[model samples]
Target: MLRGLATINFYADDVEAAKDWYAELLGVEPYFEGPGEGGTTAYYEFRIGDHQTELGLIDRRYAPPGLPAAPGGAIGHWHVDDVRGTLDRLLAMGAAPYTPLTEYGSGFVTASVTDPFGNVLGIMYNEHYLEMLGLR
Candidate 1:
């Protein structure tokens, strides 16, 4: 019943920093920046990867009430051409490695890193995803 991963949202205490950081990593500026209180940027959105998926960055002040400061909960892995390369780039960009590259066998490999904003960003190389893309 699920269509698939669409817009993935991350919250940052400093949206501007997050915007710039993500822009650099994605190799493109955000297609949209939402205005916030005090004329600050509250949100940034970038369409990235082969699918042009929407990756959103919102000011942490807008996060749901009672959300814990610690990074936990769900980690959604975005498909990438090279998990190891992507992980290396993320680490070089100051992102701490949350999980090292792991071969899951059967053409599945995955890894994750914690972004500067304290969000768990996962990357994966999935054969099924590539097959679907080829079908399209």
Candidate 2:
């Protein structure tokens, strides 16, 4: 049975750069780093946002076989109060636009940006999410 989101992993050619870039964007440092197969750090993790959802970065060399090098897939969007503002901030931080801000009716809005590491970072302002979190 499926539960809540555990971790969203992003592949990067340089794990350290990805960690530093996400640290600046999220305003927090990675809480965990992997010793990897040979004692080199090949992975890093950060627990972020209200639910402490995990965001991870793994070295591309460790990526599974058949994984595409291009950035495109099912993005897991995080809830935010200001989708546009968050998108703007990410863009200012050198993130490329993946999905422009769009209203989804009934007060729902969503957007996304592609990080320098080629991962899509999704953002959304959802009333349903706030209600579920008891934040409404």
Candidate 3:
């Protein structure tokens, strides 16, 4: 099950600049900076309410195979009350299902979707995840 949005991860070309931009946009400072090997390449996290979203900056060569090559808009992430139920609701709402809900671990389930606007959104749920948001 889900309670509220936990986080929205963003892939960025420049982590520092992106952090600054998001800090201004979200009106919050970075609460956690991930470990880096003394270089520009590293992961950064910013908190919005109880959610801690991450921004990963890595070399293009190491980027995932299917992830978007560029950034600028939301790479969707949604929290759900029930992963299966929410997926069905989204389908009824005109969202075409792209992936079926699959359990990962600890009561977590994840699935993907293509919004009407053609943006990819990931939906997820877990009791522990909800607890992390203080929603349990």
Candidate 4:
């Protein structure tokens, strides 16, 4: 069982540049830097509020094979207190929903959307029953 979304890892061509861009976008600098392998490559992380969910920047050159190229934005779904309200705010800020909300099963709702930069985002919430099942 998990508490919530932990972190999102992104590959970047230039780690420093990507970190700077995300720092500006998120309005928060990295709070922690991982230990590099011989000071060569490492990850940069920023926290989301008080949660463990983080935005991570990783080195593209050192990434495993079969993974997408560097500087490629990754899609991540985030749960909010109010999906409609959050959608409205994001829309006003230039985000667009790719798909309308739909019910997956008992007490589960999901929607697909895209940020201004083209990164896909999913929004979802669990019903009380699902929460009781520890799926939230």
What TM-score, over all chains together, does every model reach? 0.95, 0.95, 0.44, 0.53
lDDT of 2 by residue, 1-136 (tens): 9888999999999888999999998899999989776778999999998889999999999999998888898988999899988998999999999988999898799999899999988999999989988978
Tens-digit lDDT track for model 1 on 1-136?
9987789999999888999999999899999989889988899999987788899999999999997887878989998888888999999999998888999999899999999999999999899988988942
lDDT of each: 0.91, 0.92, 0.60, 0.66
- Index of the highest-lDDT prediction: 2
TM-score rank order? 2, 1, 4, 3
Q: Which 10-residue window of candidate 4 scores lowest in summed lDDT?
A: 68-77
For model 1, the superposed segments whose C-alpha errors exceed 4 Å read none
Residue-wise C-alpha lDDT for candidate 4, range 60-119, written one tens digit per residue = 666678874322344455666577776676666666678787777875676666555444
Query: How well is each residue in 1-136 modelled by candidate 3, as lDDT tens digits?
Result: 8864555555555666656655653477777776556555466566543444443333333446887653324435456777887777667765577777888878778887664434455778767768877878
Error of 3 at 123 (Å): 0.9
Q: How many backbone clashes does candidate 4 have?
A: 1
Worst 10 residues of 2 by lDDT: 31-40
| Candidate 1 accuracy as lDDT | 0.91
* TM-score-best of 1 and 3: 1
Off by over 4 Å in 4: 1-6, 10-44, 49-51, 57-75, 128-136
